[model samples]
Target: MEKLINEIDSIVMETQQITKQFQKGDEVEVTSHKLGFVGSYYEATIVSIEDANHYRVKYKTLLTDDQSAPLEELVPIGHVRPVSSHQLGTTSENRFRQYDKVDVFSSDGWWFGFISGIIEENYYVHFPTTGQEVAYPSHALRFHQEWSNDDWEA
Candidate 1:
Protein backbone atom coordinates (compact mmCIF):
# COMPACT_ATOMS: atom_id res chain seq x y z
CA MET A 1 0.00 0.00 0.00
CA GLU A 2 2.85 2.37 0.74
CA LYS A 3 4.36 1.85 -2.67
CA LEU A 4 1.00 2.26 -4.31
CA ILE A 5 0.37 5.47 -2.42
CA ASN A 6 3.72 6.82 -3.59
CA GLU A 7 2.85 6.03 -7.19
CA ILE A 8 -0.52 7.66 -6.73
CA ASP A 9 1.15 10.77 -5.39
CA SER A 10 3.36 10.97 -8.44
CA ILE A 11 0.43 10.41 -10.76
CA VAL A 12 -1.49 13.15 -8.96
CA MET A 13 1.36 15.60 -9.44
CA GLU A 14 1.48 14.86 -13.14
CA THR A 15 -2.22 15.56 -13.54
CA GLN A 16 -2.45 18.85 -11.66
CA GLN A 17 -3.09 21.02 -14.68
CA ILE A 18 -6.72 22.14 -14.62
CA THR A 19 -7.87 25.02 -16.83
CA LYS A 20 -11.62 25.33 -16.47
CA GLN A 21 -13.68 28.47 -16.82
CA PHE A 22 -17.33 29.05 -16.17
CA GLN A 23 -19.81 31.81 -16.89
CA LYS A 24 -22.42 33.10 -14.51
CA GLY A 25 -25.43 30.75 -14.17
CA ASP A 26 -23.38 27.70 -15.09
CA GLU A 27 -23.95 24.74 -12.78
CA VAL A 28 -20.91 23.10 -11.23
CA GLU A 29 -19.61 20.92 -8.47
CA VAL A 30 -17.41 22.59 -5.89
CA THR A 31 -15.05 20.74 -3.62
CA SER A 32 -15.19 21.90 -0.04
CA HIS A 33 -11.94 23.34 1.28
CA LYS A 34 -13.25 23.92 4.78
CA LEU A 35 -11.65 22.08 7.69
CA GLY A 36 -14.44 19.58 8.39
CA PHE A 37 -16.06 19.57 4.99
CA VAL A 38 -12.99 18.56 3.07
CA GLY A 39 -13.34 15.63 0.58
CA SER A 40 -16.95 16.40 -0.25
CA TYR A 41 -18.36 18.26 -3.23
CA TYR A 42 -21.71 20.01 -3.42
CA GLU A 43 -23.82 21.29 -6.27
CA ALA A 44 -23.64 25.00 -6.90
CA THR A 45 -24.30 27.65 -9.49
CA ILE A 46 -21.74 30.23 -10.51
CA VAL A 47 -23.38 33.42 -9.34
CA SER A 48 -20.68 35.66 -10.75
CA ILE A 49 -17.08 35.76 -11.72
CA GLU A 50 -15.18 37.29 -8.81
CA ASP A 51 -11.93 37.62 -10.70
CA ALA A 52 -9.53 35.53 -12.69
CA ASN A 53 -9.06 32.93 -9.99
CA HIS A 54 -12.34 32.77 -8.13
CA TYR A 55 -16.11 32.48 -8.58
CA ARG A 56 -18.90 33.64 -6.33
CA VAL A 57 -21.16 30.59 -6.11
CA LYS A 58 -24.41 29.77 -4.45
CA TYR A 59 -24.47 26.19 -3.20
CA LYS A 60 -27.52 24.11 -3.78
CA THR A 61 -27.04 21.95 -0.70
CA LEU A 62 -24.90 24.00 1.65
CA LEU A 63 -26.58 26.61 3.78
CA THR A 64 -25.55 29.58 5.88
CA ASP A 65 -25.28 29.49 9.69
CA ASP A 66 -28.82 30.65 10.26
CA GLN A 67 -30.13 28.16 7.66
CA SER A 68 -32.21 30.85 6.06
CA ALA A 69 -30.32 30.98 2.76
CA PRO A 70 -28.02 28.97 0.59
CA LEU A 71 -24.37 29.47 1.36
CA GLU A 72 -22.74 31.87 -1.04
CA GLU A 73 -19.01 32.39 -1.16
CA LEU A 74 -16.05 32.86 -3.40
CA VAL A 75 -14.56 29.50 -4.33
CA PRO A 76 -11.16 29.10 -5.88
CA ILE A 77 -11.39 28.23 -9.57
CA GLY A 78 -9.33 25.09 -9.19
CA HIS A 79 -11.75 23.69 -6.64
CA VAL A 80 -14.73 23.85 -8.94
CA ARG A 81 -15.60 21.60 -11.87
CA PRO A 82 -18.41 21.25 -14.35
CA VAL A 83 -21.22 18.95 -13.25
CA SER A 84 -20.74 15.28 -14.04
CA SER A 85 -23.27 13.92 -16.47
CA HIS A 86 -22.50 10.23 -16.63
CA GLN A 87 -22.79 8.06 -13.53
CA LEU A 88 -22.13 4.35 -13.79
CA GLY A 89 -24.18 1.77 -12.02
CA THR A 90 -22.68 -0.28 -9.18
CA THR A 91 -21.74 -3.83 -10.01
CA SER A 92 -19.96 -6.78 -8.42
CA GLU A 93 -17.29 -7.28 -11.06
CA ASN A 94 -14.20 -5.06 -10.92
CA ARG A 95 -14.68 -2.70 -13.85
CA PHE A 96 -12.05 -0.05 -13.11
CA ARG A 97 -8.31 0.26 -13.59
CA GLN A 98 -5.40 2.10 -12.06
CA TYR A 99 -5.27 5.83 -12.92
CA ASP A 100 -8.89 5.76 -14.03
CA LYS A 101 -10.91 8.77 -12.91
CA VAL A 102 -13.68 7.58 -10.60
CA ASP A 103 -16.02 8.60 -7.86
CA VAL A 104 -15.88 6.67 -4.59
CA PHE A 105 -18.90 6.35 -2.40
CA SER A 106 -18.03 7.48 1.11
CA SER A 107 -19.07 9.90 3.87
CA ASP A 108 -22.59 9.67 2.46
CA GLY A 109 -21.55 11.22 -0.86
CA TRP A 110 -19.56 10.51 -3.98
CA TRP A 111 -16.06 11.93 -3.65
CA PHE A 112 -13.96 12.21 -6.81
CA GLY A 113 -10.64 10.38 -7.04
CA PHE A 114 -8.51 8.11 -9.13
CA ILE A 115 -8.02 4.36 -8.94
CA SER A 116 -4.50 4.16 -7.54
CA GLY A 117 -4.29 0.41 -7.04
CA ILE A 118 -6.27 -2.79 -7.18
CA ILE A 119 -5.91 -5.61 -4.66
CA GLU A 120 -8.11 -8.60 -5.27
CA GLU A 121 -11.66 -7.30 -4.96
CA ASN A 122 -10.79 -3.95 -3.44
CA TYR A 123 -9.55 -0.77 -5.10
CA TYR A 124 -7.35 1.90 -3.56
CA VAL A 125 -8.65 5.33 -4.48
CA HIS A 126 -6.57 8.49 -4.21
CA PHE A 127 -8.37 11.78 -3.73
CA PRO A 128 -6.38 14.78 -4.97
CA THR A 129 -8.39 17.36 -3.09
CA THR A 130 -7.73 15.84 0.33
CA GLY A 131 -4.56 13.89 -0.47
CA GLN A 132 -6.16 10.82 1.06
CA GLU A 133 -6.22 7.17 -0.07
CA VAL A 134 -8.91 4.68 0.80
CA ALA A 135 -9.78 1.11 -0.20
CA TYR A 136 -13.26 0.39 -1.45
CA PRO A 137 -15.11 -2.49 -2.99
CA SER A 138 -16.10 -2.55 -6.64
CA HIS A 139 -19.66 -1.58 -5.81
CA ALA A 140 -18.44 1.62 -4.23
CA LEU A 141 -16.70 2.90 -7.33
CA ARG A 142 -18.02 4.43 -10.55
CA PHE A 143 -16.65 5.96 -13.71
CA HIS A 144 -16.42 9.77 -13.73
CA GLN A 145 -17.69 11.72 -16.71
CA GLU A 146 -18.40 15.31 -17.56
CA TRP A 147 -21.61 16.90 -18.80
CA SER A 148 -21.45 18.78 -22.07
CA ASN A 149 -24.24 20.34 -24.03
CA ASP A 150 -27.01 18.04 -22.80
CA ASP A 151 -24.87 14.96 -23.26
CA TRP A 152 -22.41 12.90 -21.24
CA GLU A 153 -18.87 12.64 -22.50
CA ALA A 154 -15.61 11.28 -21.23
Candidate 2:
Protein backbone atom coordinates (compact mmCIF):
# COMPACT_ATOMS: atom_id res chain seq x y z
CA MET A 1 0.00 0.00 0.00
CA GLU A 2 2.81 2.45 0.84
CA LYS A 3 4.57 1.74 -2.49
CA LEU A 4 1.34 2.18 -4.42
CA ILE A 5 0.66 5.55 -2.78
CA ASN A 6 4.19 6.76 -3.49
CA GLU A 7 3.91 5.81 -7.17
CA ILE A 8 0.60 7.67 -7.52
CA ASP A 9 2.09 10.81 -5.98
CA SER A 10 5.04 10.63 -8.36
CA ILE A 11 2.71 10.31 -11.34
CA VAL A 12 0.69 13.32 -10.26
CA MET A 13 3.79 15.49 -9.84
CA GLU A 14 5.13 14.39 -13.21
CA THR A 15 1.86 15.21 -14.92
CA GLN A 16 1.77 18.62 -13.27
CA GLN A 17 5.26 19.46 -14.53
CA ILE A 18 4.45 18.60 -18.12
CA THR A 19 4.12 21.76 -20.21
CA LYS A 20 0.50 22.59 -20.93
CA GLN A 21 -0.74 23.02 -24.48
CA PHE A 22 -1.14 26.73 -23.74
CA GLN A 23 1.43 28.76 -21.83
CA LYS A 24 0.88 31.53 -19.29
CA GLY A 25 1.04 34.27 -21.93
CA ASP A 26 -0.88 32.48 -24.66
CA GLU A 27 -4.09 34.15 -25.85
CA VAL A 28 -7.22 31.99 -25.96
CA GLU A 29 -11.01 32.08 -26.19
CA VAL A 30 -13.18 30.55 -23.47
CA THR A 31 -16.77 29.51 -24.14
CA SER A 32 -19.47 30.72 -21.79
CA HIS A 33 -22.03 28.21 -20.55
CA LYS A 34 -25.51 29.57 -19.82
CA LEU A 35 -28.32 27.31 -18.62
CA GLY A 36 -26.15 24.38 -19.73
CA PHE A 37 -26.12 25.75 -23.28
CA VAL A 38 -22.96 26.89 -25.03
CA GLY A 39 -23.09 30.67 -25.38
CA SER A 40 -20.82 33.51 -26.42
CA TYR A 41 -17.04 33.04 -26.41
CA TYR A 42 -14.77 35.61 -24.80
CA GLU A 43 -11.10 36.29 -25.50
CA ALA A 44 -8.69 35.82 -22.63
CA THR A 45 -5.06 35.45 -21.66
CA ILE A 46 -3.68 32.35 -19.93
CA VAL A 47 -2.61 33.77 -16.61
CA SER A 48 -1.22 30.50 -15.22
CA ILE A 49 -1.20 26.78 -15.73
CA GLU A 50 -3.21 25.17 -12.96
CA ASP A 51 -2.34 21.68 -14.18
CA ALA A 52 -1.79 19.69 -17.35
CA ASN A 53 -5.20 20.55 -18.80
CA HIS A 54 -6.51 23.48 -16.73
CA TYR A 55 -5.53 27.16 -16.93
CA ARG A 56 -6.18 30.34 -15.01
CA VAL A 57 -7.63 32.71 -17.63
CA LYS A 58 -8.16 36.45 -17.55
CA TYR A 59 -10.87 38.05 -19.69
CA LYS A 60 -9.77 41.65 -19.62
CA THR A 61 -12.15 42.66 -22.41
CA LEU A 62 -15.15 41.57 -20.40
CA LEU A 63 -16.82 43.67 -17.69
CA THR A 64 -16.31 40.81 -15.22
CA ASP A 65 -13.26 39.42 -13.48
CA ASP A 66 -10.97 36.50 -14.36
CA GLN A 67 -11.97 32.84 -14.53
CA SER A 68 -10.40 29.42 -15.09
CA ALA A 69 -11.12 26.69 -17.65
CA PRO A 70 -9.80 23.53 -19.17
CA LEU A 71 -7.65 23.25 -22.31
CA GLU A 72 -10.56 21.79 -24.25
CA GLU A 73 -12.47 25.06 -23.81
CA LEU A 74 -9.65 27.28 -25.12
CA VAL A 75 -8.90 28.25 -28.71
CA PRO A 76 -5.41 29.68 -29.06
CA ILE A 77 -4.98 33.05 -30.78
CA GLY A 78 -2.38 35.87 -31.14
CA HIS A 79 1.32 34.98 -31.60
CA VAL A 80 0.42 31.35 -32.07
CA ARG A 81 -1.83 30.83 -35.09
CA PRO A 82 -3.97 33.97 -34.71
CA VAL A 83 -7.12 33.25 -36.71
CA SER A 84 -7.30 30.21 -38.96
CA SER A 85 -9.23 29.93 -42.23
CA HIS A 86 -11.75 27.61 -40.61
CA GLN A 87 -12.34 29.94 -37.67
CA LEU A 88 -12.97 32.82 -40.07
CA GLY A 89 -15.71 30.71 -41.67
CA THR A 90 -15.04 32.30 -45.06
CA THR A 91 -15.67 29.35 -47.34
CA SER A 92 -17.38 31.80 -49.66
CA GLU A 93 -18.31 35.47 -49.85
CA ASN A 94 -20.69 36.62 -47.08
CA ARG A 95 -23.05 39.53 -47.70
CA PHE A 96 -22.87 42.39 -45.22
CA ARG A 97 -24.12 45.94 -45.77
CA GLN A 98 -24.03 49.27 -44.01
CA TYR A 99 -26.03 49.86 -40.76
CA ASP A 100 -26.01 46.18 -39.97
CA LYS A 101 -25.31 45.31 -36.35
CA VAL A 102 -22.39 42.88 -36.09
CA ASP A 103 -19.92 41.32 -33.72
CA VAL A 104 -16.30 41.95 -34.70
CA PHE A 105 -13.07 40.44 -33.38
CA SER A 106 -10.51 43.07 -32.52
CA SER A 107 -7.35 43.05 -30.41
CA ASP A 108 -9.57 44.07 -27.53
CA GLY A 109 -11.75 40.99 -28.14
CA TRP A 110 -15.18 40.48 -29.70
CA TRP A 111 -17.43 43.54 -29.61
CA PHE A 112 -20.97 44.30 -30.82
CA GLY A 113 -21.05 47.22 -33.23
CA PHE A 114 -22.71 48.64 -36.34
CA ILE A 115 -21.28 48.75 -39.84
CA SER A 116 -20.90 52.39 -40.73
CA GLY A 117 -19.62 51.75 -44.26
CA ILE A 118 -17.83 49.27 -46.48
CA ILE A 119 -14.49 49.67 -48.25
CA GLU A 120 -14.09 46.67 -50.49
CA GLU A 121 -13.88 43.52 -48.37
CA ASN A 122 -13.43 45.40 -45.11
CA TYR A 123 -16.19 47.10 -43.17
CA TYR A 124 -15.89 50.21 -41.06
CA VAL A 125 -17.51 49.53 -37.67
CA HIS A 126 -18.61 51.90 -34.94
CA PHE A 127 -18.90 50.58 -31.39
CA PRO A 128 -21.56 52.39 -29.36
CA THR A 129 -20.01 51.49 -26.02
CA THR A 130 -16.75 53.25 -26.80
CA GLY A 131 -17.82 55.49 -29.72
CA GLN A 132 -14.76 54.14 -31.58
CA GLU A 133 -14.64 53.12 -35.22
CA VAL A 134 -12.42 50.60 -36.98
CA ALA A 135 -12.16 48.61 -40.17
CA TYR A 136 -12.49 44.83 -39.83
CA PRO A 137 -12.41 42.01 -42.31
CA SER A 138 -15.73 40.35 -43.07
CA HIS A 139 -14.39 36.99 -41.94
CA ALA A 140 -13.76 38.37 -38.45
CA LEU A 141 -17.29 39.60 -38.01
CA ARG A 142 -20.77 38.13 -37.57
CA PHE A 143 -24.29 39.56 -37.55
CA HIS A 144 -25.62 40.77 -34.19
CA GLN A 145 -29.09 41.75 -33.03
CA GLU A 146 -29.92 45.25 -31.78
CA TRP A 147 -30.29 46.09 -28.10
CA SER A 148 -33.20 47.99 -26.56
CA ASN A 149 -31.54 51.21 -25.52
CA ASP A 150 -34.08 53.95 -26.20
CA ASP A 151 -32.43 56.23 -23.66
CA TRP A 152 -29.21 56.29 -25.73
CA GLU A 153 -31.11 57.39 -28.85
CA ALA A 154 -30.76 60.99 -29.95
Best by lDDT: 1
Name the runs in model 2 displaced over 4 angstroms.
Answer: 1-93, 145-154
In candidate 1, what are the lDDT values of residues 73-125, reduced to their tens digit? 99887777777664554445637888887877676456768888989878898
Give all candidates' CA lDDT scores: 0.72, 0.51
TM-score of 2: 0.39
Kindly provide the TM-score of model 1 when superposed on the true structure, using C-alpha atoms.
Answer: 0.59
User: What's the true lDDT of residue 9 in model 1?
Assistant: 47
Q: Candidate 1: which pairs clash?
A: none
RMSD of each: 5.4, 18.8
> Which candidate should be chosen as best, given TM-score against the real structure?
1
Candidate 2 per-residue lDDT over residues 38-120, each given as its tens digit: 22345667777665445667665654333253333232222111111223424456577787656677654555566889998
After TM-score superposition, the amount by which residue 131's alpha carbon in candidate 1 deviates from its true location, in angstroms, is: 12
